[model samples]
Target: MTEPANIPSDALTTDVLIRHRREIVDLKQRIKNRRLQVLGLYGTPIVILAALITWAGLKVFVWLHSNTPDAIDNITGFVVFFSGVTFAVQAVAEFSKELSTRRDRKTPVRELKLELSLAEERHVLEARRRTPPPMDRQASYKERLPGEIARLRKESRHYRRIHLFMQWMLFINSAAISAVTAWYDPPQPAKGVLICLGFIVTLITAAAGYFKPRERAFNLQLTADSIEQNATALELGISPYDAVEEKRNLALFATTVEDLRAEQRMREQQLDQPQQGQQGQQEVI
Candidate 1:
C-alpha cells in the first residue's frame, strides 16, 4: 500500500510562510527606496529654485562693487540656459531606459497577482472542514510555501545588489558635490557641475528603484505557478512525458521537471494494474 502523504497537523490552518525572511526584509527596503524615489522626482523643481535664488543673490551682491544691475540678469540667464539643457538630456535618457525596460517584458506582469489569487482560491475551495482529519491535507501545500519564499528571496538578491551599488554611487556623488561647493570662491563651476550631475544621477536611481523590485516579486509568483501547474498536471493523470514537454514552453520559471514526471509515471503504473480480479477468479474456481 502507498504510504499516506504527510499532512500538516491542522488541515484548516494555512502555513506560516517562513523560508525567505531575507527577501521580506529586502522587499520592505525596496518599498522604502521607491518612496524615496518618488520624493526625489518631486525634488527636481527645488534644484531650479536654488539656482534661481543663487543667481538673484549674486546680482544683488555685485551691485555694491560695480553698480551694474545688468550683471545679475546675464548670470541668471546663463544659469537658466544650462539648467534647461540638463533637464532635457536627463529626460531623454530616462525615456530611453523606460522604453527598453517596457520592451523586455512583452507580456504584462501578471505572475505575482495571479499566483496570489490562485493560492487564496485553492485554500478556500479545499475547505479543510470537509477534508478527513488526521490526514496531511495541507502538507504538500505547506512544504511548498517555504521553498517558494526562499526562491523569491534568492531572486530578489540579484536586483538588490545592483540597487545597493547605485545607492553607494549616489552617496559618493552627494559628498563630492558638497565638497566642490565649499572649495570655490565665486561662480563655482566645479560645484555647479557636481551638483547638476548628482541631481541627475539621483533621478536615475529613483526610476530603477520603482520597477526593479516589482520584477522580483513577479519572479516569485512565476516560480510558484510553475510548481503548482506541474503538480496539477500530475494529479490530472497526465503522463510524466507530457508534463515535461508542456512545461518547456512556459514563460517565466526554470525548475527541474523530472520529479513531476516521475510522479506521473508512478501514478500511471499503479492505475494500469489488473487489480484483484485474477485472485477473485481463482478463489471462485
Candidate 2:
C-alpha cells in the first residue's frame, strides 16, 4: 500500500529518463501491434465471411433475375442474407474481445517493472547474512504475479463464454435463414445457396467455439526457489545488481516484479505486527 519514493524525481533527469522515454515509445508501438492484431483477428475473418455470403446472394440474384418472367420479388431472401452478416459480425466482436485481453497492458506495467528491479537490489543488500540457496533461475515467479495471471484467465474465460453464445446466435440465425428462404422458393436457385452458406457459417462458428482459453496454476515451487536464492545469495554477501533488470519478456517480468514487491510488503507487515504487539505488552507490564 505504501507509495514508491526511493527514486528521486531528479533521477528522471539522468539516463534512466531516456530509458523511460524509450519504454513509453515501445508502449505506443505495442498498442499499434494490438490494433493490427484486432484487425487481422476480426476484420479478416469477417470480410471472408461477408464474401462467401455475398457469393451465395449473387447467385440467387442472377437466377431470380434470369427467370422471374415478369417481376423479381424476393424481399425475404435478402433479409436472410443480412441476418447472416449481422450474426457473423457479432461473433467477430466476441472473438475480437478475446484477442484484446491477450494483448493489452503496457505503460504502467513497464514502470512498475523498473521499480521492481531496484527493489530486488535493495532487498538483496538488506538480506546479506548467510549462504545462498540454489534457485531455478529460468522459471522464477512471484506470488502476486500468479494473481494477475489468474485475473487475466478469468477475463479470458468470460470472453470465451460470450463468444460461445454469439456463435450459437449465428448458428440459429443461419438455420432460420436457410429454412425461411427455402420455404419461400423450394425450387429457387437461392434455396440451395442459402442452405450451403448457412452450413459454412455454422461450421466456422462451431470450430471457433470448440477452443477456449485457460490459465496456468501458479508455480509455488519456482516462487519459493527464487526467494530462497535471493536470501542465500544475500547471506554470502552478494550484491544484487543486474540479474533482475532482465528485460527478457518485459511484460511478464514487470508483472512478476510488482508481485514480488507486493510479497515484500506483506512480509514486512507480518514482521512489524509481532513487534507492535510486544511493545504494547511491555507498556502494560
Candidate 3:
C-alpha cells in the first residue's frame, strides 16, 4: 500500500466535486423553471395587449385607406380609448408582478435557492476541513480584503453608470418626444400614441427613482471602503489595530464588517418603508 504522491492536500476530492457539480446543474435547472413560472404568471396581460393592438391597428389601417372622415374619427376615438385602457392594464399587471416577486422572495422556490447556497458553503467548509490548516490563515484573509474592496467598488461604478444612463434616457426622450409632438402637431391618432409613449417613459423613470439601485450601490461601495481602511491600518500596524493581537484583530475586522453590512440593510429598509406606505395608501384609495 502507498499514499498518492504529488496530490495537493487542498484540492477537492473527485467525489465531492462531482456531488457539488450535480447540485449546481440542478440549481440552474430550477432557476430556469422559476423564470418560466414568472413568464407564465405575468405574460397574460401582454398577450391581451398584443391581441388588442393587432385588431386596433388593422381597423385603423383599413379606415385610413378607405378615406372616410367618419371612419378616421372612429379610428382616433379607438386609439384614445385603447391607449388609456392599455396603460391601466399594463400598470396593474406591473404592480401585480412586483407584489408577486416580493412574496416569492420568501416562498419555497427562494428557500430552495438559499438551501443550495448553504450546501455550496458546506462543500467549501468540508474541503477546508480536509486540508491542513494554513499557518497564516489570518494574514491570508487580511490579504484578500483589498481584492474584495475592489470588487465592491467596481460593482458600484457599474450601477452608477446604469443610473446615469437611465437619467439621460428619461431627460432626452422626454425632450425629444415633447419637441416632436409640439412642432409636428401630428394627427389625432399619432398624437395619442405619442402621449401614451410619454406616459410609459414617465412611469419607468418613477420606478427607477423608487428602487434607487444607484444609492444601494454607493452604500455598498462606502462599506467596502470602510472595511478596506481597517484592513490597511492593521496591515500597516497603524492606530487602533496596533494594540490588538492578531486573532483579536481578525475577529474585530469581521465583526465591524458585518455591522456595516447590517447598517446598510437597515438604511435600505428605511428607504423602502415610505414606498410601501405610498403603495398601501394608493391601494386604499
Candidate 4:
C-alpha cells in the first residue's frame, strides 16, 4: 500500500506501522486457530484409541481379580462394537467434509505465516523510518515509560504463564509416576509408558532449569516496577528526584532508568548464557 501524498512522513509511517502490526496479529491468530483445528481433527482418533486402551486395561485388571469375566463379556463386546461404529461414521463424515472444503474455506497456514512475516518486516521498516527526534529527555521519558512498562509486564506475564504450565506438568507427571509405582503393579506396557512419562518429566525439569522462565519473569517485573517507581517519584518530586533544578532531576531520572534497564539486560543475558559461561562471568566479577 502506498502512503498518501498529503500526509507527513511520520504520520504516514506511524499509520502504516500500526496497520501492518494489526494485520500481523490477526494473521497470527488465524494461523493459530487453523492449526488448532487441524490438530483437533487428527487428534480425535488418537484420543479415542487411548480411551479404548485405558478401558481395556481396566477390564483386564477386573478380569484378573473377578470370577465373573463372562458377565462383562457382552458389555465389553457391545462397547467395542459401538466405539468402532462411531469411529467409522465420524471419521468418514469429518474426513470427507474436511478434504472437500478445507482448500476452499481457509487460507493455507504457510501462506498466512508468509503474510505475517512480510507484515512484520514492513512494520520494522516503517518503525525505522519514523524515528522522531525527542524534543527533551523528560518528554521522551514521559512518552516512553508507560509503553515500556506495559511491554515489560506483558512479557513477564507470558513467561510466568509458561513457567507455571511447565511446573504443573512436572507436578502432575511426578504424582502420576509415584501413584502408579506405589499403589498398583501395572502391566509391562503401563510400566513402559510410565518410564516414558518420567523421561518427559525429566526433560521438562531440565528445560525449566536451563531457560529459567520464572527468573526472567521476576527480573522483568522487578525492572518494570523500578522504572514505574522512579517515574512516579520524579513526577511527585520525591527523594532522589527531589533536586532543585528540573534538568538535574530529569537527568537523574533518565540515568536511574537507564541503569535499571542495563541491569535487566545483564540479568537476561546471564539467563540466556550457559552455566559455564555464567560461572566464568561470575569468577571475573
Per-candidate TM-score against the hidden true structure:
0.26, 0.26, 0.50, 0.54
lDDT string, candidate 2, 1-285, tens digits: 233452453343334545655655665666566565455445755665666666567658776466532322354345446656755664555456554354343334455456556655544453343212223232334334455444544554565666666667677778767576767755476766676677767776754534321111123233444544554443343545234533333334444455664664544444345556747755876
> Model 1 over residues 1-285: C-alpha lDDT tens digits?
233333453322434222133334544454455444433444545666787888657657765566546766777677767766666654454356554332212222244345445555554555544454322433344346456546645765765666676677777777777677777756456755876877877785776554454444445445546566655654554644254443332211223443443444443343333447535554776
Question: Model 1: clashing residue pairs?
Answer: 7-136
Full-model lDDT for every candidate = 0.52, 0.50, 0.68, 0.80
Per-residue lDDT over 86-197 for candidate 4, one digit per residue giving the tens place of the 0 to 100 score: 6665455446764444431344668878988888888788777676554353667766999999999999999999999999999999989887777665555578768987
Which structure among the candidates has the greatest lDDT? 4
Model 3: residue 25 alpha-carbon error in angstroms: 8.6
lDDT of 1 at 156: 56
Residue-level lDDT tens digits of model 3 in 127-155: 67654334345555667777777877887
Best-performing candidate as measured by TM-score: 4
Ranking by lDDT: 4, 3, 1, 2
State how far residue 167 of model 3 sits from its true place (Å).
Answer: 0.8
Q: Between 1 and 4, whose TM-score is larger?
A: 4
